[model samples]
Target: MTMLEGVTTRPGGRRPGATRTRVDILAAAQRSFAEHGYVLTTIRGVARAAGVDPALVLQFFGSKDGLFDAALRDDPPVRALVTLAGEGDPSDLGPRLAARYLELWEDPHTGPRMLAVVRAATAAPSASAMVTAFMTDEVMLPLARAIGADQAELRAALTGAYLFGVASARYVLGVAPLAALDREAAVTYVAPVVQHHLTGDLTPP
Candidate 1:
């Protein structure tokens, strides 16, 4: 018998609750990735947490990498960061962006997911690409364009690289002194560099 045999089916012979099932799977994946990080989070574990078959998780997300991308994409912080990059004074963009980025990492609701994404990116090429695209396309590029900056793309790249480095060192690698710094202190240290990237001259001196 086929997998659908003896099972309730919807129109077009599709399984019932397709939307809800996908949502459930994604929610479970988010939790698992947040708690366990990427290397430790398994498709089977997420499927079991969501109360769905392992095949169903694969059918929905295709693989662990896809699930990680979806979970990161679905996260609210991604959109929030994009929005934040364009808000506030252009002059104060550095401190503003740094504060918000650090706040997301410090927040209980968002930190683990951000941590998961960073950790995954280090281990997976696909995850790394997703992060690069998100930081460039979603956040920095638009912000640079909004400021009418010359070499907008380069400026955006510099800004994203700096922020990503700071985040990885503090949150992911737990680098000494940096990781030990409290949020405001971290922001204070980071804001000037971010400001320079956003508004300072890029020409080699």
Candidate 2:
């Protein structure tokens, strides 16, 4: 099944006319999770940000885990990548993924949220686990299976490592050379390495 397949939206809490409140809570949660990660973000923090009672957050989300899970589903970058992955030839998945990944980073709408997720993943254990599981189960496994690659799981891990490393260096850390490279230049150089990880032989170098 797809990673986000069965995720039902949470109920709008006990209050009537609570849609705006729920929306505010969710937006606050997103920024909080992005800024502080799972470990540091709390119901009170979210409530403070949303200017709502902490009880309201609890009523809406049930628990911190519930809120985190719902937030992930709310803005799944994987769903977008999955659509791009399935397009064009399967053998070209690496380049396709690279292109799409770059496009996502370049996108103003999605980039901030993705950056938040990445930041949280690096700083918080739960956030890291969430990202790892999402990538392994929702993303890499599906893509590997789609192309019938040998050592599919390993390939997925490797692909993730490569992609994440590049993203961190270029976007987060702002490494000089990599950061300097334009989008086309970045993809041209990185896609082949990604392709090799996806479909190439696994002999040790």
Candidate 3:
């Protein structure tokens, strides 16, 4: 059901090669956003990448933002996050989770895709609620259960807050201290904070 990178085809591409064409366009779109960021990316760039006509990108996603959303889930990032929340080791959940988050940003292809979504969602008040609700229900609920903790929802929110702060400083604002740290080092520091929220005993007063 999920399309490739930034490309999705409407299924009914029953005609000989319509499906393949749609996919190429989407993949191309993903590449453009990742390399150039949202501001610099264009439909033509994607088309060139995919070796397709520009109209195809528009035909598939309808707009650049639609394509942007599709690109973030190249290999089911959300599903992976949710699954990890349920099954990963409780003691190391925070660091593992942080590492996964960092991996997404480090991908270069998926990073810009996420940045575009975050920026757009932040700018729109309506989308903010939707994004928040999705992260909590899908990610936090399961994460809380994995840690065998009560008040899963609150814990999930706390985890999300921690993630948001780190991501904003390291990626969006490019804060020197935060951005300078490599992924492993960042995870080492971030994991404990996340563990505390998830386990409720990772830190002392």
Q: Give the candidate number with the greatest TM-score.
A: 1
**Ranked by TM-score, top first:** 1, 2, 3
Off by over 4 Å in 2: 1-14, 17-24, 35-40, 48-52, 59-66
Evaluated at residue 34, the lDDT of candidate 2 is 65
The digit string of per-residue lDDT tens for model 3 on 1-205 reads 2223544433433334877777666667655654565566677777766766667678887776666555544453544666676565677777778888888877855676667556645665544555566567666777686667877778889988778778878988899998999899999999889888988654446
Best by lDDT: 1
**lDDT, residue 165, model 3:** 75
Superposed on all Cα atoms, model 3 deviates from the true structure by an RMSD in Å of 6.2
- Model 2, position 20, has a per-residue lDDT of 81
Model 3 global lDDT (CA atoms, 0 to 1): 0.69
Which of the two candidates, 2 or 3, achieves a greater TM-score against the reference?
2
Worst 10 residues of 2 by lDDT: 1-10
- In model 1, which residue pairs have backbone atoms overlapping below 3 Å? none
